[model samples]
Target: MSSIANTDEPAAATAQGHGHSASTLTLAVGAVGVVFGDIGTSPLYAFRETFAAHHGAIGITPDAEHIHGVLSLVFWSMMMVVTVKYVLTIMRADNKGEGGSLALLALIRRASDNRRWTAPLILLGVFATALFYGDSMITPAISVLSATEGLQYIVPGFKPWIVPTAVAILFGLFAIQSRGSGKVGKLFGPIMLTYFGMLATLGVMHLSANPAIILETINPINALRFFQADGFTAFIALGSVVLAVTGAEALYADMGHFGRKPIGLSWLTFVFPALMLNYMGQGAMILSASSPAAAAALVKDPFFLMIPDLVRVPVIILALLATIIASQAVISGAFSLTQQAIQLGFIPRMEIRHTSASAAGQIYIPTINWGLMVMVILLVLFFQSSTNLAAAYGIAVTGAMFIDTLLLAAVLFSLWRWPVWKALPLVAAFLIVDVAYFGANLIKVPQGGWVPLLIGFVIFTLLTTWSRGRELMRASMSESALPIEIFAKSAQNSATRVAGTAVFMASTNTGVPSALLHNIKHNKVLHERILILTVAVQDVPYLESIERYSCKDLGNGFYRVTIRCGFLEETDVPALLRTLDLCGAPFDMMHTSFFLSRQTLLASAKPGMAIWREKLFAWMLRNAASAMEFFRLPTNRVVELGSQVEI
Candidate 1:
């Protein structure tokens, strides 16, 4: 197996400045829009779901004490999960400047030296990524559905159109993805900013009427009393309480886009305050209602109930736009994650289209986009309501969060090198909360939670199969490969020499590429100058241009070149070759012949993998993007040599 050593040094500081300047404020505003959308929209259904007795779990009483208890739980859950765990702790464990389950996994692996522990950590990371796919699908379905359900409040007669309207909105959102997010992304910050402002305003307006509710909410005693008084019911209520922090991971995952400072500032100064006020406002509204039944009905749609009737229509319109923005963030995240997976060798390459010339991160993946659209649409159709979809929501997120806790423990003791005393308490707190939430969500599996779990499991299988398959394929190829020294010694005397350059793509630096061997054997000639090129994706997000390529000259007109890139970088062989100084001169497309190997995988009774998995891997390999396109080789000058391999 090939492994890249992880660097212990901190990632080079980001070039994007986050100093106390106007640029920093601008980035912070942008961060508010993209980073907090999912959690920001939680007020729509989180409160309502907590009291929903349909699951035979928790019963809601609109008395002051019960209202205070639920509000305290929501407030504390956000503080613990979103603020303490994500904002303060996990975000600090970035890989270079990138944050995500995979990125964190890379960072931890780089820091640890124990080979025995690598497999389990990788499995944890892959499962976390798989769970993210489930979250990506559910976020859009639930966000848009919850936002559109507002139509029922505005016009009771329009209730029947909720599902259809949500479907139309979601379809439209996915349809425009191919064109790219650059154009629409400009408005996300402003729209979300306005949405949060509205949220805080509505909450403050209601909070002013019942000021005592805010005090009760801030006190931790109410939350303790809630668990003590209700016992098992309170524990079940945690399943719904988790909804308030559903999108907390996005804050950390998106840290690479906006630096930690901007994201952290945005969360503390704006997102956190706004979400608290809104949840508090809903609680206050419920407590101040005329009757228990009225409070119950009001909580069903408390987000809209808090808005004044005069501005109800505009608020619903704003809510729909906000949900769309939230959905956009999740969709874009999926694209970014898929690209990372491909670069890290967890999945096969797919066609990646850059939507914006200036932004390297702005990309569109058609397969993921369309696949997500289908799954999201089906989720909407199946659940038929945001409340129903809520049943399926927490499992994927909590599963991922649970995985993150495990990964974080590795980072704490292994990577960060925190002494056991300090790290243990922090890890324990995170684990306790993560496990509590995950265990609570497990109760929902029979109802609808199985959807995300099944999706995660299937995706996890595909990821592992592809990863293992690639490793086995490489081993098989290596077994047959000729050493560069041995090949050069024999070929110099045996083959006829021709003019011009021939570059053969190789998976490893030590072996002769199959394409090179095939060309010399069949064509009976060798280029005067031959280059065996190998591309390596490092664990980091990017490598500096000055440190990109290394070349070694071998006798008999052969040169071995290795190009290194970070996981977030695009690997364009042609582009990197243009900057090459050590390999004769800079490459000229007309003079260069790019030779690629197209492997035809066959499912054999090999010990490497199950026959079914081998077939699945073969199918994925067959459908992957062609090397000529992926490596940006000149189409007319490229030649593909086909070969069969069994694993």
Candidate 2:
């Protein structure tokens, strides 16, 4: 019942699993691969758009002061928002060192004392999750497009071929997923390492030309001036610019994989400074240039423009590698989100296969992987340019950020048991920052924000429907299960004598299984002893063996056994039973027959969904991998009884 028992010690206690702690440097490097990939590559297109896009173009002063000021805003925004707000403060709010929107939701849900607001809390989470799907699609499009567009910087004639070539490269990227990313991941760290070195070198070279940019970063006056100049305009530009820091969330989401210390250190020491210097460098480049032709020099390739032409080829290659790494991070995030959704019961269980044997968390969900790949490919093909894809990117990332702030408030007030006086200020500050970004992103809806908004709404509806429908189904099944006390008395007296154990899988510990009801209705008999074994999959991902199962003996030798499994773990009944003490419970193999209940969904003339959705749901149910196979139960011992249900 304790929170620690539910979280920390399950698989390790059972398998003698030992976790190896990564050294500080190794963790920092690895964190770059996992956490900062998306945002790391943002410099490729973020600033270029500012000079060329609507807001930037409207007030295109093309001066060093405003460019310095704009870059100053970016530098400090990363420092204040990404590094300070998230890496320093929010990362510490990790759910057992596992970060992400879900982890934050779970922790807050568990900790909150008030039940009244639970509904809205869950809705907020569902919306955030919905938004992420949009983020997933846009990340690949923008990353690949931006990198591939850089080719034109070197070869102007290649401009006509950029879109088609980018599409082809993305197709190949998605095509190779089944082979897994073990080798690709190995190269990710080294490539990002080179990319960071180039970033630092670019910054150093540009800063030597105009050291005054360093003074702007330190002064904070430029940031104030930039904001005060056109507060409303600056606020609107932030919606898109925030995309540059979207991967800030990954710092926390990936905390479990790389640990908090590494992410914290990387943000403060290497990533933050490199990002600031480069932005400032870009600002300086924009400042000195004259004319759109010369501005073309700065805008054509902001990421590589600071470097000499001799080294541009190598920078271009590194940019490609960084984008690949970024896409991989988003793909991994999609897997983690699906896993959490399954455990939380917002979605049905899917085939979750572990991609890496040694890492418990490195899983691959074929459903999500293929779904994202299709969407990503379509997005790249349609958008053709990073500028177009950028329009659709921010709603989901910022929406999720806003939800995190709300969840954090709940944590402070109820879960952490902080006083109202102390919680109010912290909550207020985050809300102001997060809500501004959320509002800024809202301005983008007509432009391209509608994509994520539509995705979010559709996903929210599905999640709500599934959660409601599952609850109703469970209630109906529970109502149908016979009370164990009455069944035990009758079975022992009147049923046929069986020499072995008869294990009926019950949905509840206090009742006979529905499969047994079907069996008795058809055959007019029940097995001797009638072991009513019930299984409860907990909300959390792991449970201890000692806490794995519990038994209650009904009268006349009918025993009710309940087994617990984490969300990430598959149910293996035989393996679970082997670990049980059984408490002198009789179990002869010849007599033991495992009974399972399989729901056969029926389409009704009565109103629920339209004919199309019913047919779609039916197809989904039929194509779904069998539950028996999913649980890894033995075919011979398992006997399934089908029942009809209308949803």
Candidate 3:
């Protein structure tokens, strides 16, 4: 379940749509800049935090054995969790070339014919999405703060400036969302390319001095020896170790932009090696410290200290830039994910604006953007430092990863039809890692870990409540509706026929909208031509232009039209109608008067969801964005008709 290209690339087409030549290389470079940001920036804090003295009493001396052990675990987690699980296996479980939790859920719904397991699968997918929201909030806080925390090493008296500086940078980042990321995205590739080059360069400098550390880290025996060396301490260390693989899921989520090959190329050939080299370099630097005091200081900030003193300041500057980019990617992912959730009917409609006219996928959501800003800022202020925030960061990510493994199991068995023998081993390996990381993170719930779980719980409730409420409202409204044939014959001669076209928007395709019935009752007149329109969202990303709209004549100048929209697409009704050729007359926004139904929900004693949820649904419905603006209808021509409905 993965990527809605939260990118503003006017010229970017998915790599699967291009040749694997120069263009493919370009996509891979772009992937390095955006797709790998989260994981790429992990070196700034992940390795150092694993052996921090402040991480309770679990951490031990960062000596030869522990350094090899930690590096071994980091290397293997990257290989298995990122390379094997996400890049190799789960990336293949795409929905029309799109990947993400909601995208995967849509794929499963479209692929499965068996109805029994669908309900729980839907719940799993929704919970995964909820966890993603939590991850998005934490990623920015931890990433930026960790990088800026490097200031103390650069300028010893700069400790107080770190928080204020991070806060300023974050505020500026969120403030720029409405302007679009096209120019910013074009710069991402170069900045990250430079950033990763530095990481590899610093790593190679240390590894050249000590090739033995490299040899010791590559063997799985070191990881095993680590567990055998400190059993319970090593297990608790996993909560920190998992921070290395935090953004692996983003690779799959972002697959629709660059395709599997480009993302794989970026990771395997470039991003992956750079990350491993940096982690190993940190280990080598820690093990080679000239003094015990130096060793202790290096262990606290291995990534920054690994660089030579002369180059440390520049590297710190680059790390800050990279972290900013990482935070931007996570924020964009949240916007894209929210758009999918709205289209899939899991969330109430909000104000969504296209930031780029050329790329439909690049969007800005005011509500989600501002909401995330508030939460992220609160997290940074509350946690006060990246070390404290680390306890909160991994739970959401690990929980989402475990849920993805479950969804992948479903995809393998049901969609791919993989034999049990092949699928079992893969699923089992993924489960071992996911369950271990998730269980380890559970140990942190009492220590700042409750933040993400609390966020996930609230989000999950809102999602389910909205989905179920929509169903109940539709059922209630459908029970009181009149069919087209019945309404048409009855209204034919009952009122004066006017000259303009009347377009009534309907939520359900089979019945007359309450707006039309209310219109006739109040106005005592009808337009010469009446159009019953319904915009339907299908479980796909993009639909063909020719199959955009279908209109069927209901006789007597009445027609029922349905607009087919893909989940990853926009619903611009008037713009779409301009291209539509109906039998009687061409669609003109100026000539058409759009009538919209605004439902006022009441929490009835009727058998439905709980009374509290019904009231919550009522509030959501009332606060939802206007259908006219959401569908891109003409501002002056739209009229709203209100009706109260009980569920």
Candidate 4:
């Protein structure tokens, strides 16, 4: 892939006279809407369950001092991991407006032109991406179930209906994906705004009642008490506390949609403070109450407990709205991840149907949509409660966080060229926090954590095998490519006698493509007018439309056409041809036949790879849907030419 274009601040900064005003506030709120869904909703269950979940065999006494200690850890974890590490520092390390594992890889690749660290960086990027898959699957299940569990709190008799209702709501959500979210996205901001307001109001009200020095939980000393009392239990608490910062990655990933300034300000000014206050309020509630069962009572309906009886209905409505917005964020994230996977060549191209005419990123992939729906339904059925889903959640989030630290360290050392002394300490701090969370979550493997790890490992193996197989196939084919001059000199004479035009798809521009070669060697025919086309998939999330396509005419009735698409956009050959006015390319497509080269990987022990990987690649290649259907081409006009590749 060619280097991704960087056109953010540095370029603008150099052009001093014309300045662009960065709206720090707007981007931050939008980022909050997009990024905060996962972590923001965690307050509904994080604390209550940490003390009561199956993982915590020895539940902490739900007393004032103990509650303060746990809440303190939650607050500090958010400050250190989300606020200090990600918001204050990591967001500044973005590649132009793009951020994520892949974006970081491109930045490091650009800096280290020597390719010495390419393998490690790319592997880390792919591994981080695989972990994201695990996170996406759980976010929906946990967020919605947690919010819906409030039903039992309002009316004790509704306990049995909570699971069924949550499942039905999730089903409807997935079913509407094909219709697109543009219609509903307009209301997400409004709904989330109200929810945040409600949380802030309830927190302030609770804080007013306990006006004594209870606010002292903000001090670092009290947080130290939890560890001193029980070090092993407190260490395990890091994994659950880390959940408070789950969505920080989205701050960087969604930076392009809304600029850096807005996202940063939103977290610092509004979202962060509101979250801290609500958590503190929960701590206060735990401290002041005189019953051992108070925590359990509040857990059933904590958000409503702060609201009076008359306003409970409004609060319930607000919480439901917030849950919908939260689910929407994760659904959109899944779409983005699928596009990135395709661009990086881990997964074969799928039919990415665009939903909005104006928004290039608004896409609908049927395969991914249906796949996630099935898995989420199964999760709702098996786990049956948010408390159960929580056990499965930390594994994915912490694993991804750990991988992010590893890649970020590579970026600091190799890309930014930071000195060893400065870089090592920063790297060590992140890794220590990340590893602690990862190890803590490991204890839940048999309970629920094994699901994501198993899925991630399976996906990672396929990704590595396919990427390596593609490399071997290219190396072997490059050795066999016929010289362009010799092919033009010999085959240019009396190739065939078709009427209007024929286009043959080739992976490389120089060689006579596999399809054309097969047509010439067996049928002894070509076309009166011929064109060879190569489509290059780019790594960036968005591409400039004006420079979206380029074509060159090779002499002797052949033309080389290359089309570029952002990782966020799908390539439609027919649509591209119509726009470029080159269906026939000095010849017309109304009378053209398009030839596509299809590769079938066969199991081999000939030494290209370990025998195990060869078998794995063969299985994936067989299972992948055909290119003709994937790209949404005209069935009658398309023809596939087959070739075998041994890997």
Write candidate 1's Cα lDDT for 15-97 as tens digits.
22112334778889989878889988998899888877747754766678778998898888888888899988999988767
Better of 3 and 4 by lDDT: 3
Give residue 388's error in model 2 in angstroms: 0.6
Estimated TM-score per prediction?
0.96, 0.90, 0.96, 0.90
Could you give the candidate ranking by lDDT, starting with the highest? 1, 3, 2, 4
Off by over 4 Å in 3: 1-22, 53-55, 291-293
lDDT of 3 at 588: 70
Every candidate's lDDT: 0.87, 0.72, 0.86, 0.71
Per-residue C-alpha lDDT of model 4 across residues 1-647, encoded as one tens digit per residue = 11111222111122111112546665555566677777777777777665664674676666666677777777778877887777776777776567777666655654556476777777877877777777777888888888787766577798799889888988899889898777777677667767777777777777776755245666677678888987887776665676667776777677667766777777788888787777777666665666767666764445557667778777876787687678778888878777777765677566777889877667788888888878887888899998788788889888887877887887788777899999999989998888888998898898899988987887788778877766666656667778655665577774766666777766665666777778888877767767776656554544566656667656676666766655445656667666774434443456778888777777676767888887777776666666666555678888888887665
What shift in Å separates residue 595 of candidate 4 from its native position after superposition?
1.3
> Scored by Cα lDDT, where does model 4 land?
0.71
Q: 338-430, model 3: which lDDT tens digit per residue?
A: 988988888888899899988776889999999999999999889899999999989999999999999999999998999999999999999
lDDT of 4 at 134: 76
Q: Which consecutive 10 residues in model 1 have the weakest lDDT in total?
A: 1-10
Instruction: Kindly give the stretch of ten consecutive residues in candidate 2 with the minimal lDDT sum.
Output: 1-10
Ranking by TM-score: 1, 3, 4, 2
lDDT of 2 by residue, 1-647 (tens): 00001222223334211233869899899887778889888888877665555533363354665676667667766866787678877787866556777767766665554389976997897788888878888888899889998888788799789888887877787777766677678877878877877787787787777788788766668767867886776777777668768777778777777878888888788887887777777777766676756865666557767768988888897888789889988888888888777666667657777677766677777888888888887887777788887777888888888887887777777777799998898888878878887898787777778888888888777666655555545555566666778877776666566556667765456556667778877876665566676566554445557677777877676777777766555565676776676645545454467777777666666455665555555555565555555555577877888877765
